[model samples]
Target: MERNAVEERVAQHYAGGIYAPDRAPEDMAIQSDTLFMFLMGEAGQREDMEAWMVRMAEAMDRIQELMDVLEARAEEKEESGAA
Candidate 1:
């Protein structure tokens, strides 16, 4: 799917509460750490590890971008409320 489509899908999912915003940062941090550990552990066992890592890195970058957008929006809301 295209990037915009993927983003839309994720937004819809988030709006539906498929993922809770309050715990998202901690959950994502733990999940990322787990994925890294698993990838590293499998690196010695898999011949295609390099290709897999490259794909995962690209996906992670996209996820990070989405998180940054969400964080900025949240901060804006907080700031507006404070003001």
Candidate 2:
């Protein structure tokens, strides 16, 4: 395919970028790793992004539990303010 043909097709099919509330399209940001992760998860499921999002929430919950455990253990230890 020629470069001009590719460009024409992309222009014809392109929808638009998703932007945050009160933000312009130019201000939109994307994390490539997270985007690819969500896409891969969606590929495996029949539904759209909900199942992947639930898994994301569960993973975050597990991380928060680990953080709370660490905080509790730190509180039990004496803090030395040595220079």
Candidate 3:
């Protein structure tokens, strides 16, 4: 499906009252056993472990960049009283 269509579908599903958007994320650290299993599953996916590490690093970097952009926009709005 196209990106817009997929987004619209997700919005519709959210509007249908399935998920609670106000839910808070848990602030919990990973346990050793869970970490070990996650690492093993990632390693099992590929011949080289570096590939998995690189993919995870890239995803983290993208998330950080998005957060920075949002923060900057929020600061701008606060300064300008645009909102």
* lDDT of residue 76 for candidate 3: 98
For residue 6, give model 1's deviation from the true position in Å. Answer: 25
Which pairs of residues collide in candidate 2?
none
Q: What is the C-alpha lDDT profile of model 2 across 1-83, one tens digit per residue? A: 12233223322332342312222223334243355334333434424345555765777898899999988777666364322
Estimate the Cα RMSD of every predicted model relative to the unseen true structure.
Answer: 15.5, 10.8, 16.0
* Candidate 3 wrongly placed segments (more than 4 Å): 1-45
Task: Looking at model 1, report the run of 10 residues with the lowest lDDT sum.
Answer: 1-10
Per-candidate TM vs. native? 0.42, 0.40, 0.43
- Which regions of candidate 1 are displaced past 4 Å? 1-47
Whichever of 1 and 3 has more TM-score, that candidate is 3
Residue 61's lDDT within candidate 2 is 100
Q: Which residue pairs show collisions in model 1?
A: none
At residue 36, what lDDT does model 2 achieve?
35
* Model 3 lDDT-worst window of ten: 18-27
lDDT of 1 by residue, 1-83 (tens): 12233233332444363432334324665366564334433443344645555765877899899999999999999989963
lDDT of 1 at 66: 100
